[model samples]
Structure formats: C-alpha cells, structure tokens
Target chain A: GIQVEQSPPDLILQEGANSTLRCNFSDSVNNLQWFHQNPWGQLINLFYIPSGTKQNGRLSATTVATERYSLLYISSSQTTDSGVYFCAALEGSNYKLTFGKGTLLTVNP
Target chain B: SAVISQKPSRDICQRGTSLTIQCQVDSQVTMMFWYRQQPGQSLTLIATANQGSEATYESGFVIDKFPISRPNLTFSTLTVSNMSPEDSSIYLCSVRTGRGNTIYFGEGSWLTVV
Candidate 1:
C-alpha cells in the first residue's frame, strides 16, 4: 500500500495572498488527483494530474512523477478557498486511491 | 462531467437503526466508490462497487457493517447497518468514467447517530 503525506498540515492565508501545498507519495502511482473539501463537507475535484503540469484560473498543479511528489499553487486566494485540500494517489495497478491527511487551509477575509 | 443526485443531504438517526444512502449518477459509470469522512478527519476509502459484483471492502470496512450494492452502472447504495454514534460521518460516493480515470465525488450524505 502506498502512503500519501501532505505538507503543512495546517495553513493560514489572508485574502489576496498566495500559498503552495505539497503532496509526496511513497511509490509510483498510476493516477493522482487533488481535491478541496469545503466547510460543508463537499469534495470538489481540483485537478487530476497523474503527471505533468496543469493550471485552472488562479490555481495550478505540477506532478513530477519521477520524484513521486505533486504541488498545488493558489495565487491571490479568496475566502471561499478556505477548507482542507487533499491529494490522492493510486499505486501501480491498484485503482483504489490512498489519500493524504490533508492541508487545512484557512483564508481570512 | 456527470451530475450526482445524492438524497437525504443530512439526517439524524437513532442508535440501533440503519440508513441507506443512495448515489445516482447522470451517466452510466462502471465503477463507484464509497468513502467515509469522520469528524475532523480525512476521507477514508470504504469500498469499491462494480456492477454485477459485490463491493471490495477496505481493511477496516466489512460487508456486514458497510454493505454496498451496485445493481447497475449509474446507481449504487451503501447501507450502514446497526449504526452507532461512532458511525456518524459524511458518506460520499465517487465514480470513474471508463479508462480516463479521474474520479469525481457527489455532495455527500451527512449522518448523525444519536
């Protein structure tokens, strides 16, 4: 089983600030995804980057598969972004994804 | 992208009772996964549901306690049997579309056992 570890278990960012979150996996992964869990417990898919780099608006993610780590960047963050961010990965042929403990982000308005 | 209509957004049930949460996907997805989010905790995988087969449970989850049914590609049900206060948490269902492999989750059903 692959272990997923997220950096900065907790984070605080004032509105209009920027932040970076990192996720490291113990082994090679067949798939990887980033998600945001809102205050109301809704899981929002942020990005599904098994490899390479992707950007959506003010948010961007990069996965260096060789190093088995991924990073998520949020620029000029907003209050609505306050919540826990999770990175999930599936090792080898396992379709079941193992998730990190999560980075609890608190964005002050 | 597909829309998932999850019922009973939130509920409070008495102990010893059971609750079955339903997840209906707009598209017929071959694989659906059930997850549990405990209070102040990260999401944990409960089981994987595939049409025409019984769900494969995770290490701590068992079929008797958390039974899952996937009768077809577009729908699945997860029943929490003999519920207790510890069972109170948010239950979510996610799906993967064919081989593309990015999974998406529903809004989740919040349960409070008392």
Candidate 2:
C-alpha cells in the first residue's frame, strides 16, 4: 500500500492571502486528487490531476507524477475556503485511493 | 459529473446494532467505493464495489463487518454490522464514472453509536 503525507498539518490565513499545500506519496500513482471537506462534512472534489497542472478559479493544482508529489495553490483565500484539504493518491498496483491525514486551513475574514 | 445521493444523511444508533447505508448514482458508474472517516481523522477506503462481483476489502477491513452489495452499475449498499461506539464515523460513498476516471463523492452518512 502507498503512503500519503500532507505538510503543515494546520494553516492560518487572512482573506485575500495566498497559500500552498503539498502532498507527497511513497510510490508511483495512477491518479491524484484534491478535496475540500466543508464544515458540513461534504467532500468536494477540487482537482483530479494524475499529472500536469489544472486551475479552477482561484484554486489550482499541480502534480509531478515523476517526482511523486502534488501541490494545491489557493489564491485570494476566502472565509469559505476554511476547511480540511485532503490529497489522495490512487496506487497503480492495487488501484486503491489512499488519503492523507489532511491540512486544516483557517481563513480569517 | 455524477450526482450521488445517499440515504439517511445522519443517524444515531445503539450499540450492537446494524445499519445499512444506500448509495445511488445518477449515472452508471464503473466503480464504487465505500470509505469511513473517523472523527477528526482522514478517510480510509473500506472496499471497492464492482457490479456483479464481490467487493474487494482493504486491509483492516473485512467482509463480515462491512458487507457491500453491488446489484447494478448505478446502485450499491454498505451495511455495517454489529457496530459499536468505535464504529462511530462518517460513512461516505464515492463513484468513478467511465468518462475520465475522476471520482466524486456523496454527501456522506454520519453515524453515531451510543
């Protein structure tokens, strides 16, 4: 089984600030995804990046498959962005998506 | 994008009881997965449910404890048997559509065992 590690277990930011979250996997992965779990307990898909980079509004993610790492960037953060950010990697051998413990982000208004 | 709907968004159950959670996908999906999120913990994959086949349970998870049924491509059910307070967690259902391998999740069923 592959192991996933997320950095900076916690983060604090003010509205309009920018922050970057990182995820590192122990083995090769067939897929990588980022999710935002709102206070209400809904896991919202952020990005599905097996490789390369993708952007959605103020949020963007980049996955370097060869390096076994992924980064999620949030620009102009908002109070709505305050939640747990998770990075999951789908292992190629077992095809199981393993999740990181998550980074708890707090954006103060 | 697929629309996933789960029944009994939240519930409270007594110890030694069982509860079945239902997962319904708006479109036909190739793979469905059940995950458990313990309080203040990350999500852990319980099993992968494929249509017409027995689900593949992950390590630390067993078929007897969390039995899954995949009757068709669009629906599935996960039953947590003989649950205890340790089983109190948020059970989530996720699906992978054939479109591009992107996975989407339902609202999740929050269960509290007392």
Report the lDDT tens digits of candidate 2 across residue range A1-109: 7899999799999999999999999988888999999998999999999999999999999999889999999999999999999999987645567999999999999
Candidate 2: residue A51 lDDT (0-100):
97
Best by lDDT: 2
Error of 2 at B6 (Å): 0.6
lDDT, candidates in the order shown:
0.92, 0.94
Tell how far residue B110 is off in model 2, in angstroms: 0.3
Error of 2 at B65 (Å): 1.3
In model 2, the fraction of reference contacts reproduced equals 0.73
lDDT of 2 at B59: 88
Off by over 4 Å in 2: none
DockQ of model 2, rounded to 2 decimals: 0.78
Per-model fnat list: 0.83, 0.73
